[model samples]
Target chain A: MIHPFQSVASNSDGSLLFFVIKNSILVYSVKDSNDEFKLVGEWSDEADSTAIIKEKVTKEQQRQLAENTAKKLKANDGTALPQEHKEAKIPKPGQGAPPIYQYIRNVKLSRDGKWLFACTDSDKAIVMFEISAEDKNNCLRLAKRQRLPKRPNAITTTIDDKQLIVADKFGDLYSFGVNDDQPCVNPEPILGHVSLLTDVAIGLDSNGKQLVFTSDRDEHIRITHFPQSFIIDKWLFGHKEFISTMCLPVWAPELLFSAGGESSIFSWNWQTGELLDRFNIAELIQPFLTENHLAPDRFQNKEGNLIEYSVSKIVTFDSLPLIAFFIEATKAIFTCQINRDSGKIALKQVLEVPYNVVSLACAETTGELIATLDNQNSHDKNFVAFISMDVDKFHINQSKQQKFDDFINSRLSDNEIANIEQEGIYPLYHVASLRKRGEH
Target chain B: MRAGMSLDDPSSRRQSYRAKKEENRKELKHVKIDAEVVAEKVELPKKRYYRQRAHSNPFSDHQLEYPLSPNDMDWRKLYPYFYDESKGDMTKEVTIADIGCGFGGLLIDLSPAFPDKLILGMEIRVQVTNYVEDRIIALRANNVKTNAYQNINVLRGNAMKFLPNFFHQAQLEKMFFCFPDPHFKQRKHKARIITNTLLSEYAYVLKEGGIIYTITDVLDLHEWMAKHLTEHPLFERLSQEWEDQDECVKIMRHATEEGKKVERKKGDKYVACFKRLPTPEII
Candidate 1:
């Protein structure tokens, strides 16, 4: 109930739910027709070295935090402004006793399902777990876990599975070799971002060079060379709000879907940086609010309420690039299918739920969406919710997909289309921050 | 319809008319009472065309009664069955809503059926809304045997605009749209109860698995309601089994004043129902 799962992952079949709860990654068999979550066993680091590293990292980070606070107090020695600011903006510290223990931020399975990458929250480490699917008794065995100079905000393996890219919250990206002859006890830093990096994804560009797509809090989506992340590529800059999530749909690797906590969802071509299509959800979500009698103003942010609805998480099904997104406050999860060919992405359906979701994942083999939901009480108990999208229900016939292919042909004027595809990179328009008349 | 009077039943209607006359007689006492004065003053109060305001805040009188938050609301008054939380052992809140309740027919019919649930009706017209209020008050007053009509209440509200002011997100399980005013003119299309603009608000109050029941005799309006609801991203047209098997549909088809009049005239009644779908990840 109280921080049961920091991160969760589903095996392709969705039968095994592997999540980082409390100290270890526990596996539960959640097969059909059964609510009984039979705990298989906890997947441990199985190394004395991990314990020593965790101890060393926690002591070091705690010392650094204390020094920073002391330095801040010394800077404000001559004034009461610091005290006034502290009094005005001291949010209830729900963080609860500054994590004396190490916690996991994310757990992702490789495309081939042979390895698991578990990223630490503040211990600045990425623990690699090798899982053999064939082994029933002990499928999960920790291979190696390495500490980094900075904690990773996002982590993902490349398509070819040779390199692992990790993005830190302090705004830097580093690539580590999967099979480096000499293991790096402390992974060296590589490229950097000026703002806090929210997410990083790996995909091949037109020339098949590994391009790392990174999204940040400053509304910038940058495409950079994989190993040589310092070599700047084109920037996809259009989001008016903080871009918290970014994903390259496995089915449509050429397209990158990015969403802030806004009502609009954007997808642009990664190679050309041309924003292929933009889906506005204001009309769709407004009715939902009214029907449920929920005040829209409650979700409005301080920045003039333009970005009221926030996408807490985005998980995509590998089958059709059918993506699942959640609005944490409203506890609403919606799925939409993006037709790369048509340049039209329509919201497909909404999943029924009554719990606040902290994380979302789509089961690899089952095509079902799994959510780690909060029970909407002071206790903050958690339970997993699942919805299966039977393949037959979504019949993606060629004719229907072809009908929407000529969208820009009919919808956009000659000048508008020219403006979009100028020099092959379409300007990603900001839906929430559209300039008013005579505002230039 | 006379304010605080029953129009469907002429027997109970004259009480209000007589009371109005009595009040007029008392006003005559302030001046001079004459036979000629009674003749002119006895007729209905002038040519009664409702003066429609541009923005109708119909629930003005009930503003003090409205709670700022759902938790602050005194639901015990609505659901008498669960007067005390610890004593009544009530587990679920009232999740059903009836929009534009004309004569309290649907409320009286559905109240006992869903005894554990709380149901609310919203009518815009002051007099019509008052009549329904009086009707429920009378029914509950005489309920010494079954304690019926304890789970329902009526209020004057422009539900389309102020819905968010009342319920929280996904608070409603079922919403009834029976014989809503057909703002037929193209210009007044926005004034119609159902529209793309209002549906999103409806989706917010209704839970992921909620259903919206719409019944109308007007074929054009029916088509319009059905078209807009089906085209909405959050709702899907409910299956035939749901429409046929649902008990709420039966009450909606036969319980309202419009439904009774439509039946008397042998008019065709078109019904469309859509389920609020769960998010796509929910499958």
Candidate 2:
């Protein structure tokens, strides 16, 4: 079996495209003439596969970490420390479960195209790469791998691009310097939520004050004052289900589009808590809601109905009022046009494809959408397709981009392909699991 | 009412007992109606019939129904006296929350103290929540002339999850976590009510200068709660002198059922209060 691309992202100009396979991140530079992709650079996880970073924990650092833990537990209370802390037990990374193999989660490229970050489940660390600003030949360079307290669920940068904020599955938010190379030793979280955090983004208010927006599995969308995350500005409590994907359009910074287990996408004015509109797509997406979207036998409803499908990816075009989004495990991509004057979102087009689209990235300069797909069913094993806007609708031009397939196929060896097949593949559709089931 | 009567089928026996108790309650309400009394005196629900296990897994997806958001929440049914039908909104919003309110003793006590403020109790169990609901109804009916218990209500909800759905930011002034489950095991520490993560959420709903009151009989859990609250960036511990002067602290120490149980057993009770400080400005 040919493993599908897990996720994809692109740089600001859309010249460099990044694809995440099982254990490696491949970078392909886009050609302006033929609109083809050239294999540029690749970084795999084989360099450092251990749970911790390559840098060994020095004795001084370990002792200091223990002391800090003790001080934190006994901050203002006059009472003595607890029995466990009295013994000075070293803190573990992830407490409850044992270690297991996991695939690379996703990749993110910075706005300036100078930094690239990806979280690896195998090591529970954020792998950072420094993109050479002037050198096109040497595109990606491994910079640092900082281990986190838990597995990261979402990653983004601060508005100023000085710090990288990572939200983990344990609902803690930690930030590190974007260019910092030192390993973090038991760093404390800056902010947190009680439920599992799914997505996080940042925007500015009317006064240009930075604000952070975080959504969780508990249907809460919180707008908090940045840096002072303790001071929550407002709570956008519109979603009744888990929110997995959130998009903040550059053209419309005042608006936010969020979707997950619900059939509709909710547009909101981030500055205030006012909801602009809720664009329901149930009728348009019903055809793609196949039996594969049904919940498992143990979790099926009494009537064996299909489970609520989750929205996977939502991206807004840079220069236009267009937004594209797709449902998890579906073959169709839906685009909507935003009327900024009235704050109304109208469905523009629905472009259907042969295979399931894994993720999407927009090239801001060229106004083209790059989509990675699960191409195991395809006879030629093509893994990507590019779409561009035609007049008022999105047109998929798959035949012109077929030349890029030869380069991708030649990069992977037959043995490596068989190895992936034997070990199975990572879950391509995971947004559905964000939905809370009846069973504990 | 024997503890173990296997021959009778436990579920059926319990069902019959519930039916009998319900009938008895109805009789007490209607049996003493007088022409002078405009409203019938409703009997309070019995505590023993509503006993349940003390622990509930916070992560489990319990069968719960909540509003899509705070705007969608219908508070008219919960507090009929506070609803202003002409304005299509409540006269006053709920400013006090009693999280994991077992038996709702604090809510009943606070009702008379803050007569104008709306107080809500959130419980996760079915029977326990029902008992609190019945208790509130009986108290309201008995004091209809004065409207003493008109501001207190109870709802079944997992406070750890979807708390934002029922409340907006800076909406609450006081929150009570009285005698929460200890979750003694080491691995279950995350399940405790007071954690670093949950404190941020509690702080979100609470306004600046808001107070969080906690009382428990378990020493370990008390220390854990105090430690986490003290370590949070948004909370500062109140001094002993401050706690001694606050009226809510005095009521919390003696108003909870767990406190009364500890008193009867001559056990110790630890109390800690924290004030939500203003968010610090980044230099």
Candidate 3:
């Protein structure tokens, strides 16, 4: 099986690109006018893989034993389950976890293009790297690997790029100095939500007051004061499903677009928490709903025919006032144009590709949308395609396309490819799993 | 033998279990109908029929329904007396919230104490929540002349996940946490009601000088709650003298079912109170 990029991101000038495959990060620099990718850097964790697997087996056995005892006892009142509660173990980051635990959840680049940030589930830590393109062989240099108390789901930097804010699965947001070397032992969070935070962003209000926006699994978008995060400003509360991704358009700073488990994208005025428009895509994407969209067996009801969808990525172009988003496990990407004065979105076009998209990125300077594909079915090894943004025509045309040919795929050893074939590709479509079907 | 025909077959057992669950649902509905729809002087729901487990997993989706925002919530269904339909708004909003309000003992005690303010009890369990609803209905029916219980109501909600969906910013004046689940295990500490992160959410819905009332039978859990509340930047711990003088604190001590049980056993009861402070200015 071929490995699809779990995440993709680009820098300010679109000169550098970042992709995550399993636990490692691959960096590529767009070479020249023709738009070819050159492998510039690579980074991987140093933990012993064999030891990690062995420890996982022991932990699994213990968990099964405890579960069996609890099941047999039928202790719903909890008073008769003292034995189970007494021996409950403290949670550790990397102990006895699944394969997703070893994969990097997300990767981010600084606005200045001088720094890169990535979070991994292995050690529950965020790794920062210094990017120096002048060094041909080694563009990324390890800066720091600061371990957090919980597994981070999303990360972003402040407007000044001086502070890194991390949102974790445990519903806490912690901010650390970008250059601080402190130990960060038992640090308290600056803000928190009662639900799992899926994404975090920083934006400025109309008066230039800095604010932080966070979305959670419970379909809430909370906006809080920047440095004084304890002071919550307001909540954008029209979404009825878990919000997985949010985009703050640079062209219209006051306009916010959000999408998640629901089949529609909502545009909002972030300052006033007023919903400007809801662009429904259920009818347009009806053909894209496949058997894979069905709810899992555990979550299925008597009918067992429930289908769900979630947006995987939402991007905005700097050269044009357009928003483009891709739904998980779908073969097409949707684009829309924003009316600047009213903050309303109108559907512009849908660009259908050959394969399902794994992730998407907007190249700031080139005015191109880069989409990574799940190319397991095809013999083609080229995994990324760049689509041109016809800004003058107000269209994202797929006819003018360029395939990104990089050395990363051809360079993977046969043994590594065979190993990936046996273990299967890392989960490329995970947004739909965030939907709640009300099952335990 | 055929697959589902055997007595010990898994399918047979599942069928019987589902049948029993359906029957249980019908009976619960009947109980609700008797309390709210048919009776003018309703009988209080029996506690034995509504018994359930003490703890529920906070992370699981419990099939709950909530409004998109505070504006979309229809308070008329819960508190018809306070809503003026012509105006399309409530005469007064819910100013007090009792989180994880098991059996609604505190709600009943505090209703007459603050007669002008609307109080709401939010519980997560299905059976326990139904019992509280039925109890409130019966009380209202029995006191129709004076309209005593019109200001109090019970809402089934996961307060941890949807508190802001039900209340606006600075809409609540007093919040209570009476005998919350201890979640004794170290890994389950995140599920506790009081933490550094959740305090910010609590502060968001509370007024500048709103009071948080807490009481528990477990010393460890009491200390844990106190420490987190005290360490929060927006909350200041009220001294013991203040707690003694506060009327709501005294009402909270003996007004909860858990408190009465602890008193019957002669166990220790710990109390803590904190006042929500003004947010500090950004430097």
Judged by DockQ, which candidate is best?
Answer: 3
Measured against the true chain A, the candidates' chain A TM-scores are 0.70, 0.86, 0.84
The sequence of per-residue lDDT tens digits that candidate 3 reaches over residues B1-283 is 5533544445556555445544644443222233344445667866655666788888778889889899888887787778786998889999999999999999999999999999999999876887787788668767766778788888778888899999999999999999999998767888898877778889999999999999999999999999999988899999999999999998899999999999999999999999999978753
- Per-model clash counts, in order, read 32, 0, 1
- CA error at residue A436 for candidate 2, angstroms: 2.1
Report the C-alpha lDDT of model 2 over A1-440, residue by residue, as the tens digit. 45678889988677888888877787888776787767777777874443244233344355656776767655256665553423333344686675455568899877777889998885678889988745556678888888886788888898778888888887778888887768677787877776788988988877788888888888888777778776677778778788998888888888898999998898888777788899999999988888888888887889999567889878886778778899998888888998885567999888887788888888775677888887766644668778876676678886645776666666664637323653476767778888877552
Candidate 3 regions with alpha-carbon error over 4 angstroms: A49-101, A297-306, A391-403, A406-419, B1-41, B85-88
Query: In model 3, what lDDT does residue A40 have?
Result: 90
lDDT of 2 at A140: 81
lDDT, candidate 2, equals 0.80
lDDT of 2 by residue, B1-283 (tens): 5533444356566667667656654443222223256356777777766666677788777878888887788888788788777988889999999999989999999999999999999999877887887787678778777877888888989888778878877889999999999998655777888988678889988999999999999999999999999988999999999999999999999998888999999999999999999977642
- Cα deviation at A256, candidate 1, in Å, is 1.0
Tens digit per residue, CA lDDT, model 1, A1-440: 13324467887777767776534576666545534345553564433445556566566566655666666654446642342222122222265654333456678877676777887654567887777656677667776667676668788888877777888865667777765544477554555554567788888866667877888665568776656453345567567566778877767778888887567788888677677878887776553342222323544446533434555667776666577776544456778888868556788886655455667787755677776654335233234556666553432222321221232123223422122222332111112221111110
lDDT, model 2, position B124? 92
How does each model score on lDDT? 0.64, 0.80, 0.80
